[model samples]
Target: MAAYEIKFRDARELAEALKALGADMRSLPFFDNRREIRSVYITDVDVRAANVIKQEMLSRGGDAAVHAHAVDCGVTESDVILFGTVKQISFLADKLETMPWWGFPDTVKVLREALASFSKKPATIDLPSGSSLAFGGRTLLMSIINLSDDSFHSESRTYGNVDVAVARAVEHAKDGADILDLGAESTRPGAARISESEEIGRIMPVIREIRKILPLMPISVDTTREKVAKTALEAGADIINDISGLTFEPGIARAVADHNAMLVIMHMRGTPETMGSMCIYSNLLKEINDFFDEKIRTAISSGVDRAKIILDPGVGFAKDYSQNLFLLRHLESFRIHSKPILIGASRKGSVGKATDSPDTAGRLEGTLAVSALCAWAGVDIIRVHDTKENKKAVMMAEAIRNADYA
Candidate 1:
């Protein structure tokens, strides 16, 4: 007799393994729901809802973890942790929909949406250029093109050099970059802010030249100013990568919507000048999740399409050394948002600190390590400096992760 345990990351992989073994196709979905267990953390749940969740989970052969006082209605509100398989959670959601007390109905809707988001494969993002970028199959790379002399990485700076920036963009496209991101203003901590006109001057020529050279290459303009974003889009940019998460100028969201361009909303607590001092967080993951919840709602309300949005956790922005590592390690937690995730950890201070290499030349290995980590976490896009090396790292990570199960 042989005893063994089969390893699979998610329901899709489990289904694939079953199908390979010639299991009945019709039974796949049933087994899919039963194979993986999910732990969902819901906050500010009312005591009544907590009790109901506990009872419903228990009925479904699952469980809910709440404050001990929750059972006696000793607390008005408490966080709830649900432990269940997809099938069990689905059943609980259905049962909650019929309950009218204590916002149970609303909880049901959000809970089900979260479950769906967690289980969903990557989605396709439609670009205004009448093209589409698909996610989930492989990690996408966004090459860096810094148009400011003040950018943190000295090698990436091409200020006042349109030809140089365009050449780098062309090289990145050749190096397997899925997107090219051009930044005119330096957003590093304590970095000086530049005028919108100055920013436009730095980026427009490069963008126009890139459009002329690589017309099919997707361009992402990294800026927090609405005018710059609008100007870049008008001059052939396909996406606006806002590090402010739509807070610096919420109007940028509307501009993205007006142009039908894609938006990369990144999380940053304060302006670059002040962000270094604002790294405090009561609960790192929960606070970030809440921040995204609010920012996403703001973007959607400002007329941005949900499908055209991407979420970035802002690894080095408003994050301390340790917090940066924490965010990278928990990238999968952000999957509940259901939007494609973009991580820009390339050549950042954290990478320097991690590998004890303070220079960009020595940090390439650390950056590639981050690239591999992001790929393993199912990240949709990685904004990086070393395009070719990071591309290889992502490919190797994906290859190992998706190796055939025998």
Candidate 2:
């Protein structure tokens, strides 16, 4: 399966593949109909204002439900579950401010923030290195420079050689990679964890060499240990891409906070060695979104700047193929958190499963397909091995996505 088969070239070809997969978009009338009606659960709402809130929601094609027996018993507090579109919720937040009951004398602060998270999401992130990348404009590519010999994708592996890694870094930078990610520790399922000293030994030279050549290149060190993160940042790496989300090393967040470097908090269930067997989620997307909220708050509490944070939903990390597809399809939905999103699906097992391809070498086109979708969905960063090919695909998709703008 070293040779990747070309299954689809154009929309017709893609449609044919979808047809074979038991999906016919032409017959599916709901393709372009996007209605996002979110349910907001407001706990311990003053029961006195329940009627007013219920009336206000119903006026805007929404509804707020309280305990069915609350009105009769005159309960002082009731859980309010309001269902409405993002626009309707924003308006309702404002409406509640003037109701003279739940409305405060000064401003409706809590409701404003709750609704704002969904309505006015952010489109860009500022890094500590005085650079910023705006999402919803173009797709940013991060080329993979794996210093580990046992990474899932053999092509991405540099065989633990700094020279080969540096050469690949130069090519990635030359091919318009917006960032270069150097990973010394392999996060592939069941891969053994390396010592912090060994990991630094493997990557510090490559990081320094890349910085010497591309001084302004954004370099991210992928690790789950604090000492590795500290030494890597001090050695010139710009971002700490922690797959554990600060659960592995308790002090890693502090290390990133102390250096004021950028953070990539990926949502993985367990260590690489344990994650494969831990591929279970009661509600995949909800659990991930909730995890992101908790982790982001934890990072902020640890003193890491919120503006420097990026999110990767951890594709293929403790996720099955169908779950990975769901995450990819809803990448745009994460915009509600107002942070940059980076998805690294390059040559992963899910892509191989999608295209009936085998191994990392056979998933190039499948990976390209994901790059196009991420670009179209306004994902901030795409980490890939084939930087040049992905750059072209993302650039074209971005151009089309922004073609109507003046």
Candidate 3:
């Protein structure tokens, strides 16, 4: 089943979108008939286009409801809510393109693109090094390689110890891990930030070792700084797992763009030092969605290829324990962006709280619990320290959700 919805570049908030995954194996839309048509909300519509759109939709067996002020000239801006089947919307799309004036052509383009995005979401991503990964088809594990000594998970902290780091990387690979994410600077709350040079120094040897030993493995350099990212990429890292979503450093986007590398953009409210204090939000999910929307625009405008981008909701970066649990439960809502989502809730404080395990290392069960649920929710990537255990959870949940018992 396919859904019908409108997406505008500058429109204000619309109603709650009807989005979720089902066992039917149907694509984006749920259904395409009069009995199951979806609503398209368009905010910030100008008077000229609003009137034209209202009349046009009405003639095509659908109708647009507009604010009353649009007719009386009381309000300069009009918000129009259109309801129709996919076929009827297609008719309006065609009719709008042929119109000579009053912003119909632009509206036509927006409508067409929105409809396409809403209908089909490509799950495979092409990497920069001439490879591609298919997501939403199977569960992929991204093992964490925290290179900072002050990392919350003591077991994962290598503290720039190359020998220890290499061993962990090798262990993760042997544990059926699909990917390795090497992070030099710890983003744990109140953890000290390292300089760019120091960060590069800490992770370079580990990245080099991984590339030399496991040349086929995909390595992601998890840093927000462009200098470290570029250096790491030069050292054979294929992806930039930016915690700041390219916000901390303005140059990070173009660096990834220039390298033509893969990008994993995670969302966080503030810096690690400040995030704990600023964790409050009126609506956590909606704000995260808005953050993704803004970052996507910024990335594209800064020359990033959309296909190479992935999303992570930043589970414990700024969120409290309850909020983190809420995000994992409704993880499906983040799918609206049509990008692969990475859940890095491995041994975070939230997991510790959930399982009543005060120590981060003992939260393996709690971590696997989130991983299994995310796999069931169709999340593409699960970053965890316990690769083997998380893999089991993912496979078991996937077996039930996808009916792949074997």
Best by TM-score: 1
Best by lDDT: 1
Q: Report clashes for each candidate as comma-separated counts.
A: 0, 0, 5
lDDT of each: 0.89, 0.79, 0.79
Identify the runs in model 1 with alpha carbons over 4 angstroms from their true place: 19-22
Lowest summed lDDT across 10 adjacent residues in model 1 is found at 122-131
lDDT of 3 by residue, 154-223 (tens): 8888878899989998999999888899998989987778888889889888888877788878888899
Greater TM-score among 1 and 2 belongs to 1
Query: How far out, in Å, is residue 375 in model 2?
Result: 1.2
Please give the lDDT score for candidate 3: 0.79
Model 2 clash count equals 0
TM-score of each: 0.95, 0.78, 0.75
- Per-residue lDDT of model 1, residues 36-125, tens digit only: 778888888989999989999998899999999998999999899999998899899888888898989778877977787876576677
Which pairs of residues clash in candidate 2, taking residues 3 or more apart in a chain or in different chains? none
Supply the TM-score for candidate 3: 0.75
Question: What order do you get sorting by lDDT, best first?
Answer: 1, 3, 2
lDDT of 2: 0.79
What is the Cα-based lDDT of residue 357 in candidate 2?
A: 91
